[model samples]
Target chain A: MPPSPVAVSAALNVVEVAAVLAFAISGLLVAADKKLDAVGVCIVAGLTAFGGGTVRDVLLDRRPFFWVERPQWLWGVLLLCVAAMLVLRARHFAVTRKAILWPDALGLGLFTANGTQAAIDLNLPAVVCVLMGVITSVFGGVLRDVVCNDVPEAFSDHRPYAICSFVGAWALIAAEAAGWSLWASLLVATALTASLRLAAVHMNISIPPWDAGGGGK
Target chain B: MPPSPVAVSAALNVVEVAAVLAFAISGLLVAADKKLDAVGVCIVAGLTAFGGGTVRDVLLDRRPFFWVERPQWLWGVLLLCVAAMLVLRARHFAVTRKAILWPDALGLGLFTANGTQAAIDLNLPAVVCVLMGVITSVFGGVLRDVVCNDVPEAFSDHRPYAICSFVGAWALIAAEAAGWSLWASLLVATALTASLRLAAVHMNISIPPWDAGGGGK
Candidate 1:
């Protein structure tokens, strides 16, 4: 039997919170690497955790942003930033390349699933729903990179980051079409996306850069 | 006598169009400088023209973006980009530093006034209204710079871009408090902002960087 609507909603909320926490950690690590001040860390962490959802809500014309409606999320992100900063200061914790990957992948999967569902709820077209999913998964990191004066990893990293999100969005859409429960679909999609991202990272997979020479690379 | 409501509305529309056009041109020039492809040019120009207003609308929960409602604006920007590209290719029309300053200043002024008015109409808080105005005037350029892999001129340049917008927003608020007409308020605010920005550019005025040392520079 399919999960009840209430159960699905609760599961999704858990996923959202987990995603927010994971993304915030990734952002805090980047800020620490950049040697930004306290304010910069807070700004980056907030943007990384909430920026994509904010963009999705704005595009969908949803009032009172997700964080705005749940002010606790904002406070939670703030507290996390403060704690992380103190922890980093107290002990010389080196943020290696490997440190951020797991959290980033988990956030990407969860956010992609949630954003796709949100757009589906709004009755947007299928393509747009998928696009929103990709945007929600990737744009926060894009904004974080941009603000930190790094080339947006989403655009230039040549990785499977956005591509994985796109595939997972389709997975959710397909599962829904097959009449699966929302929670089941979310689990499947998130697992697929997260595994694919991790696999890509492990294998050092990459897409070629867009050729400037006018021929498709 | 104060301008009629109809007249004020019409003038604001005109200002919006002019600002969009000027900002689009600035974006196109930047794309050309970076040797981005045609698609890149279109994306940059579109973002530079619409990004700020889109951000303001999203933050304020306004539905159906301005360009989404009036797609002619998007078409107009496309045409402008095409024309500009052809002209630049046909003749080496150097896009000098001076070439961008005037239109950028004008767009900054007009957008600041219109954004402030929009927030005021929504009855937002005074600080939020001022911030919306500044975001409307500057966020587009910030987005364009980010996409082009350049440091956002607004934050790092410290050349009074957002400061001019903030001052203009306050000017409009002050004019309304003094019982001035909408048209008069807009004119005063725009002139003040544009002039200040131009003056800053001309005089090479810049704010000091945040002191990394213990001492405030």
Candidate 2:
């Protein structure tokens, strides 16, 4: 049987909360690495956690941002930043490429699902919805990397990161087109994206960097 | 006597156009320096020219982004990028710190006035209006630097960049509060900001970086 609406709403909430925490942690890691002040650290963390949603809302012309709607998310990020700062040693703080990928994959899936669903609910064009999904999953990391003075790995890493979200969004669209229920579509898309990301990394799969002559990255 | 409403509107239009052109050129120059493709150059240029205004509109929950409202801007940027690519050599593409400052100061001033007026029209709180103005003036450069894999000079570089915009925005607010005409308020704010930025640059004045205990930028 299809999941009840109440169960689905609860699941969606859990997924969103988890995704925000994951993105916030990722941002704080980079900010702390930069040796920024506490205020700077929290600011960067907040940006990373909220950047995608803000962009999505902006593009859709929606009002009262997600954080504004649930102000607790702001406190949650602040608390998380403080706790992580206290607990993480330099050793624990050491973030390898692989180390960043796991949580990123999971967050990517979760965010993409949420973003695509939001656009789809508005009956937007499929392409627009997919792009929104990709933007939602990828832009936070882009903001994080950009603030840290690095080229966004989403654009530069030659990994299948955004492409995974793109495909996952398409999957959700396809599931809905095929008459699947809302929760089922979201879960399937999320699972596909996260697993696909993990598999790509495990196998060292990559995308071709933009062929910007011989000089570009 | 205060300027006629028609003249004021015309002047505001001129300022907005000039500011966008200036910023777009700034972005294209940096992207070309990196040997980005034609598409990349155009994208960067568009982001730099439009980023701040987009942020403002997003923050205010405004519909139909400026570019969307004026689709011709998309074409204008594309044409400008292509023309620039044809006319400029690698030597011309070389941008010094000083080189980026002049047009930037002008754009900062122009955008700040427009942005502040926008928020003031909506009767937002003074602080919110001022911040909106700052974001409108400063975010384009922030976006440009971020895309180029550099930390935003606004947040780093120990320069009195955003602060200048802040003061300029307040100037606009102050003028309006003093019962100045709308156009007069805008010009006063713009002139104050652009001149202040030039004066600061000429004098080698800078803001102190965040005290990251000898670690951060």
Candidate 3:
């Protein structure tokens, strides 16, 4: 028998669409923040949505990437960007813009869960699955950062639980393999990432320091 | 057998250094054109130097990248950007400055060589090696464009034989596999890429339009 699809395996096609839209918003927000031109905004938004999946496909040697296989993903990003541009020109968006960080954070959570699940479905080792989750979750942002000319926050000192996404992904996988329901595992994983990130931002919590063997701070 | 030290690959290495420096300069020039700050300049220069290689490694699953493994590469890029800034500020650079286009073309030639050689060393299939070469040559500039709010030249309608790098890399590989010496293969590939690019720039060369099956231009 063929192996199972990842969590919500039967409903994966739906999840994929949602994940794409979420990440597209992540890209769109950055483009808007930069006040990019329409073409520029669309490209960035599309890249943010599909970049991680593309990297995953290349790494896993899966051909005809997600966006390539499903051209609608690209269309969605383009349309979304165009809509965003229209909205921006029509009125100055306030703090409660439709494409806000919270929605993006939800997308990040779903992507982290789905990516981990996909890696697990590939029958890779647990550590690799977790790594895949982190890579997929933060990849869009990393591309965004690189384009914005900043060192990737995921690799830098400031962010908390950017690494925790990897940890949570592994936890989800372990639970699923131990006969937990797919929903239970995904819920746990998503909650872990969202709460950790939210707390980090709001409470200014951080991961404890490693011993650097130096006197600098 | 152990691979030859990069030093034994002296001319190729020199070309690689020149390529990296030229690429870094292009990145810095763009940043300066945008009137960005010092951190932004370093970020752009560093990305231009390392972005292609990093993308290649991630795709190939090669971890602990060259810049990460040899921190000296990062230091070199940082110093180059700093030196450029000092020199630019000390005098009006326009009279003395060679335009970025020539250096960008030169960088493209050398990076194609480096990337082709690396793929060959890895024993990837010939098509894959050629593809890797193109990735190594242009993805940095693509990333730079995306971040700087410009369309990627690679995907734009009007760019020249950026595609030629892939073609030349394959030719070099086939020649080497057919018993050509390393130097001979390198010369042929480099000359083909540079001359073609110059011709394309001067002659307004472009990809020939496919004869649409429906029979329209």
User: If you score just chain A, what TM-score does every candidate get?
Assistant: 0.91, 0.90, 0.84
Candidate 3 chain A lowest-lDDT run of ten: A90-99
* Per-residue alpha-carbon lDDT of candidate 3 for residues B1-217, written as tens digits (9 for 90 to 100): 2336554356555656777787898888877877779999999888888888778777666668767766887899999999889877625557434566677777777778777876676666665677567778878888777667665655444446456676678778977878877777777777777666777777786643211111210
Q: Write the per-residue lDDT of candidate 1 for residues B55-148, one digit (tens) a residue.
A: 8887987778788878999999999999887767623546444588899999999999988888877666565677678889988997898788
Clashing residue pairs, backbone N/CA/C < 3 A, model 2: none
- Tell me how each candidate scores on DockQ against the true complex: 0.10, 0.12, 0.05
iRMS of each prediction? 7.1, 5.7, 13.9
User: Which scores greater on TM-score, model 1 or model 2?
Assistant: 1
lDDT (Cα, tens digit) per residue for candidate 3, span A146-200: 6655576667756574666776787788788788877778878877876676666
Residue B163, model 2: Cα distance from true site in angstroms: 2.6
Q: lDDT by residue for model 2 over A103-127, one digit each (tens)?
A: 7789999999988987886789999
RMSD of 1: 7.1
Best by DockQ: 2
Q: In model 1 chain B, which range of ten residues has the least summed lDDT?
A: B208-217
> What is the lDDT, from 0 to 100, of the residue B173 in candidate 1?
93
On a 0 to 1 TM-score scale, where does candidate 3 land against the true structure? 0.55
